[model samples]
Target: MSRFIPLSVPNLKGKELEYVTKVVETEWVSTGGGYINEFEKNIAGYLKIEKGVACQSGTAGLHLALKLSGVKYGDEVIVPTLTFIAAVNPVRYLGAEPVFMDCDDTLNMDLDKLEEFCRKECTLTNDGLINNKTGKAIRTLVIVHIFGNMANMERLIDIAEEYKLKVVEDSTEALGTYSTEGRYKGKFAGTIGDFGVYSFNGNKIITTGGGGMLVAKDKNLIDKAKYLSTQAKDDELYYIHDEVGFNYRMTNLQAALGVAQLEQLEGFIKIKMENYNLYKEEIDKIEGISILDFNKNTRANHWFYSLLIDEEKYGLSRDELLNKLNENKIQTRPIWGLIHEQKPYRNNQAHKIEKANYYIDRILNIPCSTSLAKEEAKYVCDILRELER
Candidate 1:
């Protein structure tokens, strides 16, 4: 047997120990410490956003972002069906409905259909406000930058602006991706949205055991987000509460880990991109395997290097290859099941989900972790190449 190859894992070679050790010595292991604030500052600095509120997890961040976006009972938020359910669950958390949108080959919202739905299926009321045909106010759009490849943010932003929709970005997979062209020139993925949320789950590019950050362009919105995360309390001498709040704040221990992860984010992104390139170069040459595409206008962190299998050409399906890869201890995964197809979201309106279904069976995410060496990446692709032929 050979060493097992992990799909993705944390890379902690930076200040994690030093910061955590200091917190332990100071006896401030929970939420009370400088590291929490320092970690917030570190991430804000790295992302160059107005502010970042660290929370219990990315799901919590999405919850806060939706709440802040004024997603209330019976509202509709347009969301991609091909995403981790966390991206859409927050909409449900607010008692809001998610109008499912389809994904293009880029694994992003299909703008053409998104626009078509807004124009044809929806009508502007006498108030000149667009509302869903179901008579619900379509209030927000939750755009996930899936697998570190950015959605077309500029066009998406334009559509949001036109529809009077608040945009909340699920940027959990796109920590270091940025655009170099169009209206999004020099813009990072999450920063362009009304509320940008990130995850530091254990398998993410960076990890704080489990944590999340919420960022926004407005300083007041960011402050309000922090307030909401801290339990919506007014100035408190005796824990006076104004509105319902959540204990969603990140702990000092998690922030200590975050500080360390922040210090090494750039290096981790470099390794991830290099590994993606290596996968593309080595695997794309095979007859029936195609490397996933990245948006050149923006550089993706290349979180997951996906291979789209030509099932017809190879006389095999993606699941067949997936099973074989698993048998060989080469971990690979299928893309997320479309959310609209799920039991919970079945009643929600879906627009043109054909493209999402197209890529769903074909896309297989390969290991492209920062911890993976060049040789290990080559070996994984070699397995795929052998399986292909």
Candidate 2:
């Protein structure tokens, strides 16, 4: 009970050490190596996508995806305010602005509000969807699959096609998630969009220490992204650079870790699902707090479990509960603050940000790591129950 239980952490009990040791033994420690290629292929094959481009981090992958989507200066991209700020920062990196959208009960972008914003707040032009307020072209939609829950892609894709918007799926937290029904049946969260991005951060569902992968429906786009990620080398022999590029390529060490981690992804997801169900069963019986459920039509990775606390019913505010848990050595965390309210994005457009604000204050992420023991989960629940008035 004295040990600090973390909210989320990497599970590396696979071939990570063996693969990375091979990389080190071969002296292929930098970006150029077999590990990177294998990691890319493994991720692409896992998601059943055409191709993937490995990059330094999820932020880098997002930047590359936005650039490949033809998002330009003076353009606008739709994003969710309920997600990590990294998802929204890429829009600005491309010299475009982000139009923050609200979240639904599932904490994904509100499809209804997105449709409403596109229909009532913008005008369809020969070029594309144009914002009436700023007269800027609304070029792309960045959809973050928050906490591995698949967004309503079936409806979102319809909205994108009707409005001529390129869709970028931020599948950073949804590597193992897939749709089990509808037109995109069996499609992974990242594959159905114009571009899909995944993260391998230290605390993600998988870890490469730090890296990311960019995938797209078009193989040519993947090729271009790989080119850009490695400094746009038109001719590597001459070190010729025809276009501006970035040093976003992932290291051989990271890719080695990623390749091994990806091999155990299905198993890790199994553990995550089991732990999530265990928490749900126990927390459901506790008044004023319950575990949020993923979409029924999809097999989610169950990356992170959200604990919804009703202040009045729970007898404590989210922060109060968070503090008590931390004091008891349980590492619980509140959801990210609404991005629209952040200082840097304060002036950006946020349409009907109602539900996001409501959830932001009530939702706390509890310990759900793949390494979390069953007794540890029970201990967390017992602490919550004890703290409940």
| Weakest ten-residue segment in model 1 by summed lDDT | 124-133
User: In lDDT terms, which candidate is top?
Assistant: 2
lDDT tens string, model 2, 1-389? 98889988888898999999999999999998999999898888888766799999999999999999999998999999999999999899988999999999999999999999999999999999999999999989999999999999999999999999999999999999999999999999999999999999999989999999999988899999999999999999999999999999999999999988988899999999999998999998999999999999999999999999999998999999999999999998899988999999999999999999899899999998999999999999999999889
For model 2, where is the 10-residue window of minimal lDDT? Answer: 42-51
Clashes of 1: 0
User: Estimated TM-score per prediction?
Assistant: 0.97, 0.99
In model 2, how large is the Cα lDDT of residue 256? Answer: 95
For model 1, residues 164-232, the per-residue Cα lDDT tens digits are 888899999999999989987878889998989999999999999999999987899889988888888
Clashing pairs in 1: none
| lDDT of the structure predicted as candidate 1 | 0.87
Error in Å for residue 123 of model 1? 1.7
lDDT of 2 at 386: 95
lDDT of predicted model 2 = 0.94
lDDT of residue 208 for candidate 1: 96
Backbone collision count in every prediction? 0, 0
Model 2 earns a TM-score of 0.99
